[model samples]
Target: MMLSTDNHAPLRRTPLYGLHVSLGGKMVPFAGYDMPVQYPAGVLKEHLHTRASAGLFDVSHMGQIALRPKSGRVEDAARALERLVPQDILAIAPGRQRYAQFTNADGGILDDLMVANFGDHLFLVVNAARKDADEAHLRAHLSGDCVIDSLADRALIALQGPKAESALAKLCAAAPSMTFMDAGPHEVAGLPCFVSRSGYTGEDGFEISVPAGDAERLAKTLLENPDVMPIGLGARDSLRLEAGLCLYGHDIDTTTTPVEAALEWSVQKSRRTGGMRPGGFPGAEKILAHFDHGASRRRVGLRAEGRAPVREGALLFADATVGEPIGKVTSGGFGPSLNAPVAMGYVPTSQSALGTKLFAEVRSQRLPLQVAAMPFVKNTYKR
Candidate 1:
């Protein structure tokens, strides 16, 4: 599925573009910009380096949205957002982040976003491909006094891997203690930055939000650590896939609901089945039904045999069934850490059990696969 794009390609650069090229980055077109797909280190080496040490990524293509309400009642604005997403945004405390997806009237996902209540306004980081769609959706349905301000001048950077914390801790003005999924603004390298104890790689890391102009300087300062090296988009994709994280357009879309993606736990029961604060939001009925019953197609992890990787669009067949194909691969690649191929996709609920055997059609050959629990690689999230 192609992401909607405007007449103008809308390709823009982050402050780190020059720095990336200086480090011998292999640039590619991603989310409509000149982005580094891999550095001179290559995807394999970059992936291993990040798993072992620290990798700094320039993720400025992701959308940064701020909701400034007339009343400045952040909770009220959060309620407006909660009506759109599955996460408990209204009840989220300060200095915390919630991963949520916007659903349409039919309970299908429109876009996935990270909402942060920044005291005065509701902050969001949206997928680059879905930025326009997400912004329009928010603008059309927002409550009174809410205004959507897309922070185009802001840049986002992620420092991921095991040694990420110690490297960043040196620059932070104060020792900002953080748990997984936590977020706070801090002074880094004598410059103010919004630091979140979160990342897509399933590793312990932080996403730093800074002014666009300052991104290059801050990135340079952070990469001063011997353990820190410039990572790129190629490693990012493989890392997240190995960690069992979904990519928005590939793994989820308008027809994919939270329940089908195995994200039912993201919606709290209290808000789901109409607890104290009932879920009276859009697609609540469908979401609740899926919660009470379940979805027809459920996303699961599959461990494939041999060195061959089953990529997205590969049809899944349970026990060699011809007419009834279970599902298709969403994201799949060779996992360096596991030394085997890993893939994730949706399959019928009956066959979603662990150790269930299945077949993935790769070219003319059908490769045998075993249904396994997700996070094919162990998640090192600080939580």
Candidate 2:
């Protein structure tokens, strides 16, 4: 659902543009880039192939930023960032990563991003669509002691699936030893790179950040292995949807709060009551209140009753098809991994329990829906 629509304006291309085209990538406008929606093997094959083997993904369109404290104190920079997000940045040790979000004054998410500690500085990777706004917000709020540097000179690529370890280990031995969420510098094929043991798919993988000039060579080097194949945006969407991961604009947006989005677990313990540091972030009062007393509505996974895959914006109704709508699907599609239609939507807390039934008003038909548990496909993360 984060896909971009075609327009008269020219679309930007990543450094891997020629390589994607060489591999017969079906390029489309996405997040301001002419990204591949799928390869010649197609979305279904790409999805299944990623689950079974390894899939190479060009994610350079994402924004990568680094924050350094001007003052000699590293903890000062961490504290300054903590003031913008509810997560505990001070607790993230060097070479480790944590998920966080920038919230508005009303506790609604501005964007979800990954924060990694690099000893002297903190590295942040934000969504492409909101990168400019996120950078401005950080500058506006963060104290003058901290400096934000956008890493426009780098490109990011993800090698994901069961074979990700062995494939990457051939290039960098340190890769396989890293557990999920671990990030650090590594040398790959004589190239200096930063490899993170993380990815969007619910699979064991590595997201590598390399110099923009060398991105194509790095990608080609990885593709030389028989286990890896080029994956595109289409399979990426279905894979994440099946894994129950929230998309930036679809599953989460400015109007949806963290509590209602079921992302309370990301909030660090130190930020909550009875902790060392409490209530310093933006929207702390309203967000923490919902933590104590749960939100009236909560995001839940839904399973449609037939072959038809319910899609985004499908209205949901309770009991019968004719009544006031209860909720609507935020992200939905045919899950290639599950071989069934899976979706995520917001519903009343009363009807959020597992096994509770609802109806999705899709194309004038009342499709039976069950409030199912998330991650329709179990996560294969390297814990």
Best lDDT goes to which candidate?
Answer: 2
lDDT of 2 by residue, 1-383 (tens): 57676587688888999999999999889988999999999999999999999999999999998888998667778889998899999999998999999998888899999998888888899998888899999889874869989999999999999999999999898987899999878898888988899999999999999999999999999999999999999999999999989999989988878889999899978898767898888788888888888888999999988989999999998975478899999999999877899999999998899999899987788899899998899999988
lDDT of 1 by residue, 162-197 (tens): 999888889984434787878877888887788888
lDDT of each: 0.85, 0.91
Pairs of colliding residues, candidate 1? none
Report how far off residue 378 is in candidate 1 (Å). Answer: 1.4
Error of 1 at 321 (Å): 7.8
Instruction: Give stretches of model 2 more than 4 Å off.
Output: 6-8
Residue pairs with backbone atoms closer than 3 Å in model 2 (clashes): none
List clash counts for every candidate, in order: 0, 0
Pick out the ten consecutive residues of candidate 1 with the lowest summed lDDT. Answer: 1-10
Distance from true position, residue 198, model 1, in Å? 0.2
State in Å the error of residue 188, model 1. Answer: 0.7
Q: What's the TM-score of every candidate structure?
A: 0.95, 0.98
Task: Please report the TM-score between candidate 1 and the true structure.
Answer: 0.95
Instruction: Output the number of the TM-score-best candidate.
Output: 2
